[model samples]
Target: MTVDRLGYLGFDASDVDAWSRYANNTLGMMTAAKGKDSDRYRLDSRAWRLAVHRGEADDISYAGFEAADAAAFNSTAERLRQMGYQVTNEPDDLKADRGVIDLVSVIDPSGVRIEVYYGATELFEVPFVSPVGVSSFVTGEQGFGHIVLATPDLEKSMEFYVAGLGMELSDIIDWDLGPGGKHKLHFFNCNRRHHSLALLPAPAPKHIHHFMIESASLDDVGRAIDRMERDSRILLTFGRHTNDHMYSFYGITPSGFAVEFGCGPRDVDRSWSVVRYDSISMWGHKFISPE
Candidate 1:
């Protein structure tokens, strides 16, 4: 019942070559091709944090949440079944692909695949080395970073993630100027990371809205923006979020979804009281992509 962190993410994209270039040249992720089609990218010591599998749909394939251990995995599976969700034991072949010891799988209200597991394979043989001259990534107990998912029905999604999954609510943003939009943002945290997952209004492409990766240095973000200008599509202009206080800019990936390269976000804890804000960002984060 205790979901620990936002573990690895598996995404399916048609163009693995494009993803490889963007990950290595721009984001500075340690990259390796998986099999003949898929490619895995590493931001930390973990075998892989993000997997872009070659597929027809350019969308998030599944999200893995780290459970405490074998006991936790069994407890979580039972908990989900008691809640009326179909929790299935992950097959061995899939486990090998995910690099996890054990896990249970379930589909959320929005039909997104969710896995709860422990023992992600950590690579001690080859340490993470960013080819783009960047320093270390902001990971560890926080996991890779936050991922935002779009759902048509917010209440159902909340019931699955918050009530069923038991992820801690970090904050909510009902930002409206006056006649402000009806869209609502719900941020959830597992460990110290401000939000491991966010449930947002589903506009279109009802998959992952974006996933974030934070840099230890602000200069790295600036450098990425410079690199993004030449090769990638810009989604959100440079901005700071009012809730997490993450200074970041959003760039469209080769798969056509956005990734927030951020820095210096405030950490959260049990004492962290959930608050509501009226704005998405404190300074920037303007919508740059075509609507």
Candidate 2:
């Protein structure tokens, strides 16, 4: 049994103040709680979608992928064990922290921590309203959105996500990054969303490249571009991806990793056929701010 959509992403963040502002003002995500050390951001009705922990690395902590239910979670965990992965069930407190009924943990071949779970606790009793006025986020069964990871061993990482997790190949991109050279981006999807996970294993940095959060309206994306323009941490200018057709821009978060904000990416279904591309974007994702 394969996992569902991308559930949530955690981070080892350095500056809570900067992230608090970036999440609220730039990305327009609602703040659940902000402390001196830890901060929680909410995009939808979920208790929290992104969690920032006090750390020095300023990298990904772990990415949570949801399972359909208890049976599916168990099946996926068992499959991992059978495939020689040392999977372990998380304790009650850890599950409580994640707002999930239960979870199983495993590290992928690329050393990325993964949490597979079911029954996420929703904040339905309390409606979600962004503290900073902005349009809603596109999340539900599709999960908190997609993440792309960079690794030195692409084959192993690809096997882990595909043969191991059973995600479908959405498309492949051979990006000609000019002076930076070339790399292959393999897009995978578990649900209707174009891609919940993408793999890039070359000149690999042991961190998540970026995560995409689809806005409910095109105007919301435009508003965010304005914020990025003033913020100075903007990484890539506004652009549309060729495969997913995601019109978005990338900005470095307080944690030093980029976050993609955009809208109107096409979805997939049973009849979808995978294809490869020469370019990652149709146009405009040029480098905007200093890296």
Candidate 3:
């Protein structure tokens, strides 16, 4: 499981219109193309870094990780089957949506659909237009930011991501859930972006708590919140997080999902520090309630 980077993510949206508005108007991403069932948003004008598809439920569709080459993609698929998990050649829609030469799909122990692929289709002609008339997102260099998903089996999910996918642990947060004696939330990083994915214990099988995108600066994050609240009447947190050190907040997407608009995420060199686990959140987040 030698994943090169976190390639892209898919969302199952019950309301594509809401996501369209949220992605285009609030997040400052460019909508490169759209169709009746799905729409693609450009984080760095490489076709799309995020795809939202019309569906019956609003949830995370899948997490796609990049393999170094076509051989690596096939090898991963064979390894997954050897481990007693079912793997598939990339679905028709997935292949078309990602514009990849080859891909393999498997469900993790926690039931999250994971896609491993090589050679993503890119667009040179598509120019990124900031929805807020600003500059651009800090992707391409950092790749996209992190996505947090809820899992019932926290420890096993951690093993799958850290050992199976080759992501390194950044830190772990133990939430004081009253009588529960502090449940666990783990963060893992691949590229420089803080925590490409996180695990949260919840009753659900495997669903995203929220997915984040890195903005240019703190001011860009603030402007996004202001516009979302004033014009769209959508409300959420406006505070900085302790873990990532991102001055950010969460708002509901049109798909009835949460999106974290943030900037200034703490990056790592990987070689310098030993993996650290901490108890306290970097800053107090009063907006998002603990469940």
Q: Candidate 3 lDDT, tens digit per residue, 171-270?
A: 7777665565666677788777777888878664338878888878777877887877854544346666666678777777776667777787677674
Superposed Cα deviation of residue 39, candidate 2 (Å): 1.8
Clashing pairs in 2: none
RMSD of each: 2.1, 1.8, 2.9
Model 1 bad stretches (over 4 Å): 33-37, 175-180, 289-291
TM-score of 3: 0.88
Which residue ranges in model 2 land beyond 4 Å of their true spot?
33-37, 289-291
Tens digits of per-residue lDDT, candidate 2, 67-160, equal 8888888888888888899998899878878889999899998788999999987888888887656768999988899898988788888888
Give the worst 10-residue stretch by lDDT in candidate 1: 175-184
Best by TM-score: 2
Best by lDDT: 1
Can you rank all candidates by lDDT, best first? Answer: 1, 2, 3
Cα lDDT listed for each candidate: 0.86, 0.85, 0.74
Clashes of each: 0, 0, 2
